[model samples]
Target: MQKLIFSFLMALASLSAPLQASEPASTHANITQEVNDWLNTSLSNSPGAFSFELRPIVSRLKLDGCTQREISLPQGNRLVGNTMLRVKCIEGANWMFNLPVKISIQVQYAVAARPLAANQEISTGDIAMQQGDLATLPGSVILDPATAIGRALNSPVAAGQTLRQEQLRTAMAISQNQKVKIIFRQDGIEISNEGIAMNAAAEGQPVRVRLDKGKTITGTAQLGGIVDVGP
Candidate 1:
């Protein structure tokens, strides 16, 4: 009778031991799910439509049951491309971890169809739409061919090179040493004078012009080579 009772007690203890161990596993699974859900939500609402690849956490961290978990991007870090994100458990233990994430967005942007020379005006034929991952590209890429066409290149670009906004500018509406009408308005009075453009400029940009009296003045360039100067 005594031996049977001891055997029964041992079996009950063994069963309870496994049940107790499973608790930590369940908590770990819940933490992973929470982190994944946060990542999916953040990536889905990013600037462009992107596909994301998340690296698996190397080691399983057995944290306490968390009542609250917060995920945030690192300072100055855009939620795009390869970046690190910080996840913190605000409740239970208040622990944090950094997660590695990769984001890729398929984009159609303008590229140079041919080798373009510096100061060359971009024509319709010079720009072509190319499909690529925007996250992997550099600088502010030009998305539309219409925006690139009719603009002058600031520097020469090789064929197949991606077009960037900083690389192009509006074609000069006013040229250097050209005649321009400088208009000024003050106190309801309008004045106009003829000046020579000392520097070339695009429409709506500032230009330096030499007045008829040989004095240099800076004014805003307008259409038809007109410069507006303010008193």
Candidate 2:
């Protein structure tokens, strides 16, 4: 009687096995598609044209079937450099994946036409346009020639070197100890006063000025040695 009961239980277990096997599994193609869709959206607003390719997915790895997926780049990554994109199943499964990516971005930037000296003022002839991948270049590379022209370089630049925004300085609008016109406007009324500048400052830069009565005030330097005393 005991052997008969054991045989009956084994038959019932076999009948339920098919249901578990049919539950489902995640496929490699679906995961790769999700990554491609996400990458295209993230780079849509970049300054220049870009392209990316994902490394081949592991074929033998298996995970729970995913109904929904969450994709993101690691923090501090802009998705332009060779980096890893993370895919996590937010529904129907609890698995995460990291896929390697190869990126190529093309952007136009200014490069020095010839060797330049420190403190040399820039002109239109000083630089030429060049194109390269933004990921491998400096973060602050100057893309517009207008931004670099008329500004003085803080350090020497070799020919073919990329021009950076911070390497140039704006022309000074006010000289130290120079007399400047102080302008103040309120309710459409304008007032003009004279002050002695205490320090040299470039346009839009703060400068200290001493008034006639030995008083000092801070104001922004402007064109023609004018100091804007009020908004």
Candidate 3:
């Protein structure tokens, strides 16, 4: 009696071993085949030229970190992998489709913040306008060149248009300088300061001088060289 009972128990144990071991592999194989079939069907039925690619499906399986592979559907098309297949059509297709998309994504968790939330975009720049006094702040997004110039006096600045600091400073300085007439007399020849000097003078160089409305008179003078005229 004891020997017969032992033999029966051993046979039961042997039967249970194969069933347990085969469960997971059978499940995985079934899932893989189903997904492949669904994708193949969708690709064939797609209207016009269509493309698709497999994306890694990331989700928790039971208590373990499971990698569920999926495809990143082109355009707004809907596609999902579950026991029951999910599919839907989209307005237009933009990206191409690739196959199998070997599932390699690890399950991730959401903590303090949802790290997987849609990406946040950064703004480049904006335009604004000012309406009040020159001292008051402008209330518009589009910025004017004049206002920008005032703010950029001492700092490095880049704007919608490229203006060289050296060139701009030179032009502004020339605009601010007082108009003066330069005149020179060499023997019988008489020449005005404007005729003699194409560029503004150095601090100590002597340039022929005359007032804009005055006579042609030769004087030792400097160009941009500041001179205290009149007592």
Candidate 4:
């Protein structure tokens, strides 16, 4: 999962030169420190707070420790709950083994404060903040309430349901037949005019409008029903 991949990348920074095969392999205490160090370093950028526990290696298993080796995790899976890391020796004895790690990440995500109907515009009161583990929730859960505000839902959301980006629709900044302010700038000269939108458009999307003079122009849509044209 993401946590393991991140730790593996940071592991590159702490890698040391291979020691002689006769040299004693890394101890459990050493691994605990190294693993925890990288795990803390890389996960600091995560959107939520996290805690992890490194499972103890069996004393009976005489597998070579990673003094100079690569640690990787299975792909196409999120890094949470119970997971195993593959540690392969690149120097000394040719050996490989698996180490178990458990991760828990708690994030503050947005959820519906009340039952919301489809296409209903979202307001501050419509969403409430909830704290829970990321693994138990939808991957695309919205973490910011500002992201949901002013947007309409694609389907009805039950109260207490976690909000996701895919379930919401972005509010259009332009609408057909609506009067939109148009701005034009060329050769350092700027002018403003008004026009009727020929088609609906979202912010930053192209829009066509008919001016007072019966001339049509294409421009980039802006918020507040404004459009920018001419360079």
Question: Which candidate's lDDT is highest?
Answer: 2
The CA lDDT at 29 in model 2 is 90
For model 1, which pairs clash? none
Better of 2 and 4 by TM-score: 2
lDDT of 2 by residue, 1-231 (tens): 999999999998999888667646878898898789888888898889999989988887787877788999878766787888988989888988788898888999999999999978899999999999998999899987999888889899999999998899996788899999999887899999999999989899999999988999999999798998886
Q: Candidate 1: where is the Cα deviation over 4 Å? A: 1-26, 45-48, 144-150, 184-193, 211-218
Candidate 2, lDDT over the whole model: 0.89
Give per-model TM-scores. Answer: 0.73, 0.76, 0.24, 0.73
What residue pairs clash in candidate 2, if any at all?
none
Ranking 1 against 2 by lDDT, winner: 2
Going through the candidates in order, what is the number of backbone clashes in each? 0, 0, 18, 1
Cα RMSD for candidates in order: 5.8, 4.2, 22.0, 13.2
Writing each residue's lDDT as its tens digit, candidate 1 over 1-231 gives 999999999999999998666534226456567767877787675445678787766565656545677878989776678988787878645577887888788778888999999999999999888888878887498876888878899999999999999999899989999999999989999999998999999999999999766789999999798998888
lDDT of each residue in 1-231, candidate 4, tens digit only: 999999998777556433334457667666566667766875688788898888876777665544476666657545666677766777765777778888888999999999999978899999999999887888799998998899888899999999999999876789899999999989999899999999988788899999877999999999999999967
Off by over 4 Å in 3: 17-22, 25-30, 59-231
Instruction: Select the stronger candidate by lDDT from 3 and 4.
Output: 4
Better of 1 and 3 by TM-score: 1
Angstrom error at residue 151, model 1: 4.0
Task: Give me the runs in candidate 2 sitting further than 4 Å from their true place.
Answer: 1-23, 114-125, 146-152, 184-196, 210-218
